[model samples]
Target: MMNYHKRFHARMLFALATMAFPAMASAQDIAATTAPASQPQPGDENLVYEIAEVAGIVKVASIGMDPIKDAAAWRQVVPGESLGRGQQIRTTFRSKLKLVARPADPPTVILLENSSRMTIEDLAIRNGAAVSRLGLGYGAIRAGVAEGGVRSDMQIATPRAVLSKRGTDIFRVEYMNGRFNMSLSEQGRGLLQAIQLQLSNRGDVIGMKSRFVTPGQQVTHRMAQAIESMTFDRDININDIFGLVGNDKLFTMLNDRGFGFLLPFNGASNNIFNGQGITQGEDGVAPFNNGLFNTQSQGVRSITDGNFGVGQGSLPNLFDIFRNRDTQPAGSKKSMNEAMRSIFKPKARPRLNIGRVRR
Candidate 1:
């Protein structure tokens, strides 16, 4: 009899690897052969921007480290026009951000200049559509808890597509063949537009390949051109692309390693929220959000029951051996019963015993 438990684990790994293989294999296909960040191409411009909002009287800070460590810093970034479309840009604090203590650089504050509030509903739509396009139905796990959390912290990217988020704002950041499209909520859109304008004024031409819109567009060239013209006036790095869009190469490499990577495209590192959902245990199915160990055990027992092994035969019990650890005394009735039972038990005998019976 083969060990079913071992087989099950093997199958699960095969499934995970099989699913991840294409994503990793595809990473190699999208490699970029370019000079290091130190050297800029003919028209390459360094740019940076930060998205923040104001609430009540004080400024709640949200900022993170520079995504690119050695990349040039935008010491002289120019600000663009404030997104003043009547509605009050409530740069209110949405949630507390996760921070790591660093010795070299201390934490910075996040300032809300003119930004809007983004909702979860807006992002759910685009995530659903994107999964649908990949021919994958929205399962409980889609945007739900992954092996790590309630959702995959993964920011999927293709030559023409990107799905990422900051805080509650999920942005469908896309750029295909020089066309750019960004899908976010009203608040997210306003912030993105502001950042785009800031980058354009700085002579950053990358935004021309992108646009910030809500999801559901069939993707058009006109929209791409319009996005391309939306520039920033700051020194932008390869890392700052996230505020408006993302660089395809950076996304692919991160996906290959099966780790979550989100960066502050703008200067407001405090605003960059990168929690990869909820974490279950090593079981991958166990979640930390609602239930604990007992819940996980019950779920496991349900899956590995009677039908999982041989029919009619019980599963092997490790504790059974310990049941007879303290043997009965020599003359005890229990010992006699055990000894007699073994002796009288039918042994494996030949099917036919004929010998001298005929005599």
Candidate 2:
């Protein structure tokens, strides 16, 4: 039965690929083959953050070292210890971390919810003010700026979202498994634009594409200029787009993998968003606006009275997984696996659609 399902999924994906963006797929292949390798990243200057507080099981490791499961790596951190550039910070199940960005004008505070990972990308500080950028590899992070915290320059980029603010504001970005060059994403608060870059297997850019998204919009990524998907995506009226968009690579990938990737692009009939239109956690906490764990489970669902195995009838289906993810206790390890993994490997080439996009 399991094997039958797998074959069915593969066939469905192949059919969609052919029916959707046959032309773009071919172009993507050519672009990928002809693209150059990514250039080496230069070593950045040293910048640092301090651990303001920690909840259950937060782990800190350097980008330069192997996984630190030994007591030493876990014990090395004290509240004032410096977290330099190129380091990774993670929180285990039921854990939260508060980090203070060093030397900032209005001061900056970063909160990492459970099952999240972040990397320090760049930091430039002078005269008690700092410009620090961090990449949210996956999971959720909320950045806080002081009142009047608007910095014309602060930027946050995620696999699916790029957020910037003209004034001091609080924002959150969750990365649920996307592999793409983030540098091409623009920086700003109003109507963030997307730059779709087609990359070679070696991670070099060969071609590019784009779109415009309103505040609170989510965009997924794919390789090449699969004009097929990009084009049809734009035809949906902007207002209707929210209700009808987003049946791209992520949807296929999740449906196949059984993590319940079929989301309500048809609008918010799903209970995930509440009557007031604010996202609610299992605890029924509405609006992840303020707190360490506000959006911790953003891409996950809760599993109540069931489990999400390939068959064991544990989870029964995807929606059940969503239930577990939303209601599960914070830092619950079992619930963690119920989240999305960045699974769009282009070699097998999930079918893509590039519809003609009209502004």
Candidate 3:
């Protein structure tokens, strides 16, 4: 009887130990699994931009050290996709793209027009400020920055010049061939500076010259020439600037964000449908008065009537037509399909096509 009781007690002790051992191990495993969650993750402090909307055809490529070699493969972009440093985005004819910065406070919006190629050179939070640098190969982009509370240093670099801004501002940059243009909207309350680089015979930067561009002003520079600053002849129209007259979705998104002041209405005061319809007393009426009805009517007529007036010797006007078109060529559609398909295909080394390299 004693032996039997002793044996039973021994068995119970072993069973309890066995169960407790596993419980102890599980607690350790749980602790190990969750330890990293409290640590800062890699790239957590980096600034990232998400594709809010995409119209027509747009593509993105992962750029490496050698742009020519790494940029050979491109895939179609979709909305909600995130773009980080070392990425390049381009739009085809009749295409437009919208990007909204992550950590959306102090909103930053970027709009890429048709036939534009832009590369994200750097996007990181450094020294307590969000720093961003964009390289524009050829095309137009409109960027709006509202420093809700954080400090921001944003720059758009072109072949000819670099446009830099600190704090809140709405600006547009266009580059073609060797010409560059940058303009600050009427509502821009921040400072904008244009820096032109002087290069040596070996294509090395020797010096830089910078000038401040005030609100409601524009700066233009041509290769081997001085920069020209001028005031806008008339009230700029946001619809015309972004080719967004018919794009109700994008127009509403921007307008609701109080970006209407970027371009003010220009029409007769007596016109019943004045700019008031859009401004809505946000920043008060535009400095220049204009009838919203007339502006929109002209935009619609230009698109529906197919009267782009491209042959009128205005390169910007020609690009505007391409940006505002509702339809793309059949070839573009086919290529877009192929690009999307390539994403799922097996990895194959890209063949280098040495045509005009945009970088």
Best of the candidates, lDDT: 3
lDDT of 1 at 202: 27
lDDT of all predictions, in order shown?
A: 0.28, 0.49, 0.64
Worst 10 residues of 3 by lDDT: 25-34
lDDT of 1 by residue, 27-68 (tens): 211111110112222442221112232223222211121324
Q: Write model 3 residue lDDT over 1-359, tens digit each, in one string.
A: 96566556644544454365442212222222222212223554767899999999888986433335655587789999999877788898999999999877558999999999888876766666776778888999999998676677677778767777755478999999878888899999876777665554644444445667788988787422453223334444443432222344235535654545544436333334334434332234322224543344554322333334432334754464445333546557665555545544677767687777666
Of the two candidates 2 and 3, the one with more favorable TM-score, higher being better, is: 3
Ranking of all candidate structures by their TM-score, best first: 3, 2, 1
| Decoy 2 TM-score against native | 0.41
- RMSD per candidate (Å) reads 27.5, 26.5, 33.2
Candidate 2 residue lDDT tens string, 1-359: 96566556644544454356532223222222222211123453334677888888777775434354454554335566678655677777898888876655456777887888776654555333354556565777766666334232344545433434333334455667664322111332444333444434644433444444444554456423454565566433222111111233234334443534333343454434332333543344332222222223453333343333432233344665566577879888754563433122235644456776555
Error of 1 at 1 (Å): 61
What lDDT would candidate 3 get against the real structure? Answer: 0.64
Look at candidate 2 and tell me the lDDT of residue 28: 28
